[model samples]
Target: MKHEIRFIINGESRSLTVLSQQTLLEVLREDLGLTSPKHGCSTGECGACSVLLNGEVVNSCMVLAAEVDGADILTVEGLATDDELHPLQKSFIDHHGVQCGYCASGMLISAKALLNRTSRPHEEEIREALVGNLCRCGAYADIIKSIQVASRARR
Candidate 1:
């Protein structure tokens, strides 16, 4: 059955018709044309499909589109405002946290969620929060440093 859902995406309100079984990531990429959230391990094991659901980090690949009805969703593309990058995004560039760039979007969203809740997360907390995100380039140090830099800048 197709269901009509109203949700806020990237700070914009949208109404979409979606299948009950469709994942948010699929809907975002296929239906809405928001492709920043990559389709990695569709099983939610990979944080590559991470997004912010109501300001909390979630694996979009694991979330049903119907479940997000009337909810607020934020994709990596929403991080920038008026062509200005989010602090995390800027920090990632400044710290060279991106290599292959496949995991960058998810990592940025995860970091954004963490900073949203805690403006200044400790290094250990940052590491723990990002445990789900796997960067093939092994840029863990730079990623952590980027978050720290963003956190400091936000203070």
Candidate 2:
């Protein structure tokens, strides 16, 4: 059955008709054309489809589109404003944290969720927050450095 859902995405309100079985990741990428959330391991173990639902990090692949009705969603593409990138994005670039770029979006979103709640997180906390995200290129050192750099920038 198709159900109509209203949700806020990237600070914009939107209404979508989605199938009951469709995951939020599918709706966001295929239906809504928001492709920043990569389709990695669809099983939700990879965290490639991470997004913010009501300001909390979630695995979109594990969430149903119907479950997010009236919720606020934030994807990687929404991180920037105008032509400027988010501080985390800039820090990632400056720190050379992105390797293959496949995990970059999820990593950034996860980091944003952490930084949103805690301005200064310890290295262990940062690592714990990113436990679900998998970077095949082994750029964790740089990724952590990027988060630390962004934290300093925000101070």
Highest lDDT: give the candidate number.
Answer: 2
Candidate 2 local lDDT, 1-155, one digit each (tens) = 99999999999999989999999999999989999898899887888899999999999999999999999999988999999999999999999989899999999999999999999999999999999999999999999999999998987
Question: Cα lDDT of all candidates, in order?
Answer: 0.92, 0.95
Regions of model 1 farther than 4 Å from truth: none
On a 0 to 1 TM-score scale, where does candidate 2 land against the true structure?
A: 0.98
For every model shown, what is its TM-score relative to the native structure?
Answer: 0.97, 0.98
Poorly placed runs, candidate 2 (over 4 Å): none
- Candidate 2 colliding pairs, count: 0
How well is each residue in 1-155 modelled by candidate 1, as lDDT tens digits?
89999999999999989998999999999999999999888877769999999999999999999999999999988989997998899999999989889999999999998988888899999998898898888988999999999999986
117, model 1: CA deviation in Å? 1.2
Q: Score residue 134 of candidate 2 by CA lDDT.
A: 94
* Model 2, global lDDT: 0.95
In angstroms, give how far residue 43 of model 1 lies from its true place: 1.6
* Model 1 poorest 10 in a row by lDDT: 39-48
